[model samples]
Target: MSRVQCPRCLRPKTHCLCPLIPRLDSRTRILLLQHPSEVNHALNTARLAALGLNNAELIVGEVFDDLPKLLNCPGYQARLLFPAEDAQPLQAYSSAPDEQPLLLVVPDGTWRKARKLLHLNPLLAALPRVTLAAGAVSRYRLRKAPGPGALSTVEAIVQALQTLEAPTSFEPLLKPFEALIDGQIEAMGEEVFQRNHGEGKA
Candidate 1:
């Protein structure tokens, strides 16, 4: 028999992470575009991010037909959170209280899938790009990072929010993400986790 799942958080009833998800408000709006394939993945961090932030939205699809409405949020300058040669560093907005808060458009998928998202949505690609500063680390231990600054969807959102809104910590948003990781580790058993992905392993 299948286990029941929480209406929110979507974790199995026995391991529900709803209690840890926060409903924090942010000046900057977040729009997470997730590939359909990622919806049912065991670690659907994008859903966690959407639930935790009052100003965020999560949409699942390969091609977004409503890019016009999605990117046209008033009082917020829309910026794609993807690295590019000319992308502006996110830290630039940290201290700019006079400037408009961003409508951060993030693609939640693997490297290739995220690229596909940008490819499919020209308007999404046309938005000015913003990137996190270098040397940031990922807290997700279960999977190999695709690159140096790779982070899970929730982690990336937290980092971006914290950077764009300095002094207003968004660390609380990560509570459920951390819990989910711990649960995965516990389920894997210490011996297997240590042998495969423990300290200095992956």
Candidate 2:
């Protein structure tokens, strides 16, 4: 028989990070666009980000036909969280209190797949892009990144929300994420895992 999974975090009962999930009420909302294939990936951080933030929406698809409706959602400024060379630093728009509250659209997938998301959705491509703070690094030890300066979806969302909304509201969202990574490393139960993910580790 299969082990029971937590309906919320979708992890096995012993591995569920739901208890540590924060109920963050961020003024800036999150709209995550996930590749259909990544919905069941064990290390998915997009779901965690949505689960933690009260104002988050998770949409799964490679090509979206209803994106127009999403883009036109009232009272929210739609922006893509992509790291294109010309992307504006997120803080530039965030520090302004007069700007519309953000609806941050993030893609969840490998680098190639993420790029495909941009390519497949012109609406997503045309949206203004926002990049994270300089020197920001991902603490997601569970998965190998596709390239340098890559951050998991949750990490990026957490960092972005910190700038876009009240700092205190988004900081706690990472606690469950850290716990998830630590729990997975502990389960690995090998010297290689222990030595690599030590103190001061990324």
Candidate 3:
């Protein structure tokens, strides 16, 4: 049987999440440097993030040759969002090379894949890096984070933007993400899904 795809989200019909996606605009433009492996992942949140944001750009590749061109074209302060131990907290920085609009370049993939992106892209690594505040956790129930403080790509982007952009909550941006989780739970049956996730009393 040929697998039918959802036109909006480009996912299989049984797991189509386009209906839950919301169009959002942000001054801090989002640049998702997604690993080729994740572009089509069934449960990917990075795709949702890119589609939901008005100023977001999704670039798929492991090692990119156009990093200089993309960054120069944006004319914004491009910053890398990752959890590397050396990444500085956004709050700690009070300045930049100039007062240009911010462009958040996020690496979307597994921890290892994300690391490879940074390593392969020297320009990305050289850019300033920001990490989520301590204790931020992932509400992405569909996947297990690789380590403590790990969050889904979309969650990190929203939280980082919330912190830097001065919003009491950018949480509404995550409602569709939550709905995606809920849809999966509904399909898998709440009790069974919860049991597997070790949530509540089984």
Candidate 4:
């Protein structure tokens, strides 16, 4: 077997191309609170999103030890990116005045882990929640969701940025994410095809 490492996430480097990632800049700042476990996983989209956006920050941890400082960033309005039964929709938060729209707080992890973060962090729960109305299919083929339209962190951010009418720079950043997912799907399909066809030397 070939010993390849995933370029983007730096895992065994196999089946991952996150390293060829592109950079992006946007008017709105994104703050991703990622779980430690998710950081080590090969399918982490938060890392890709952070790499694409210049104004985005990805912090790996279970708790926001520096919550006070983050909340104090000047001219920034912080809102949690989540789907709560009682939370306001993402469109509502995106429509807020741009003059005070600097920060967006997102929890990066699986549904279970993300929920745990919300339950454990009362401060995060107190923050306003933003739920997205995304129409695009998820790019993460390696990961499964409880339901349809559950997107990777990067896709969710892209949808949110579009809704918020963020700068044009944000659109291009989504390209690499699309590329990475397509690459993975293509590679996997080739492997399956070859296996089924018995093209390899017997």
Candidate 5:
């Protein structure tokens, strides 16, 4: 029989990560546009990110028909968190006292899937884009990263939040993610993990 799953975190009941998931508030609102294909991913970090942040929303789809309303959130300026040739570095952005906080729109999927999202939603692609600083590595040891400086969805959100809201650590948001990684490693056995991902187990 299939193991029972937690209704919230969607993990098998025995490995449920609900307790480690944090409920934190942030000034910048986050809107995650996740591809449908990623919903059942073992980690599903985008869902974790949405659950942990008070001011966040996750919408799963390829074409978002309500882009106008979603992008026009009051008191917030929407910025797409995606890389581009002319992407603005998030570190250089700061809200003035009179300015609105950011509504960071993140796409959750593999690079190809994410790009497909942009292709399907022209307005989403047209938004001003922002990117994280280079050299930050991902802690997702189970999967080979597509490239250097790659990060999981939750990790990217944490780094983006930390940069946008400096001096206020968003580290607690990573508790569930770390637990998930540890659990996966343990399940796969140390020898197998060491053989595959031990080189950069950060």
Candidate 6:
């Protein structure tokens, strides 16, 4: 089988239709601590989210040896955007007053991979967990969730930031995600039509 490069990003891209990623400045800083394995995935939205925000940083690794240093950075409050049983929703923490900007750290990977990162990295676990509201669909169609309401890293970030009353610039960042989803649907529809008409044959 021949691999087709994505017409947009020019990468051997998957059908992930997220649009031209936008870059916006936000008061809440976003730090996406992604697993190395997630970087190459065509559907990875963390990369797209990072492209949309000026204060966002996407770091790839299995461990964070410099966790303390990152936490100590000036004008930043570090919090992990993970949904734990005991964790509070992002809105609760977002309303808290602080002179510093909020640093939202999200782990991007499968359930097993994310769990491994959390387990192997004690520093990450030390941070307070921020959860989102229950009952949301995942934007990623390629991966199956271990359970319901498991959101992709990008969706989690957007939801969390919205709770914080993040700047209006964030709206632009969401456009790419919409574009991507729409594009994927269109592509899939075309494929289905072609197949039904026997035009997809070699």
Instruction: Summarize candidate 6's per-residue lDDT along 111-141 as a digit string, tens digits.
Output: 7888888998998887888788788776555
| Tens-digit lDDT string for candidate 2 (1-202) | 9999989888899788988888878778789999988988877789988898889989999999999998887888888998888898876345566778878899999878999999999889999998888777678765555566678888888878777664455777888878888877877875767577655555
What TM-score, to 2 decimals, does candidate 3 have?
0.86
List runs of model 4 lying over 4 Å from the truth: 1-20, 92-98, 166-169, 191-202
TM-scores for every candidate against the unseen true structure = 0.96, 0.89, 0.86, 0.78, 0.95, 0.76
Question: Which digits, one per residue and each the tens of the lDDT, describe model 3 over residues 21-98?
Answer: 778777678899999999777667788888888989898999999989888755678778876678878752245656
Candidate 3: global Cα-lDDT? 0.80
Evaluated against the true structure, the overall lDDT of model 2 is 0.83
lDDT for position 42 in model 3: 64
lDDT of 2 at 130: 87
Clashes of 1: 0
Report, for all candidates in order, the number of backbone clashes: 0, 0, 0, 8, 0, 7
List clashing residue pairs in candidate 1. Answer: none
Best by lDDT: 5
Determine the backbone clash count of candidate 6.
Answer: 7
Clashing pairs in 5: none
- TM-score of predicted model 1? 0.96
lDDT of 5: 0.93
Ranked candidates (lDDT, high to low):
5, 1, 2, 3, 4, 6
Q: Of the candidates numbered 4 and 5, which has the greater lDDT value?
A: 5
List, residue by residue over 1-202, the lDDT tens digit for candidate 5: 9999999998999999989988999999999999999999998999999999999999999999998899989889899999999999887246567867899999999999999999999999999999999999898878888898899999999999999889888998899999999999999999999988898664
> Model 5 residue 40 lDDT?
92
Clashing pairs in 3: none
Residues 1-202, candidate 4: write the lDDT tens digits.
Answer: 7577665465455545454566666667899989888976656778878877788888888777687788677977888888778766665234445557648898998888988887877888788777788466775555445577788888888888877763443566566666665765676797664565333423
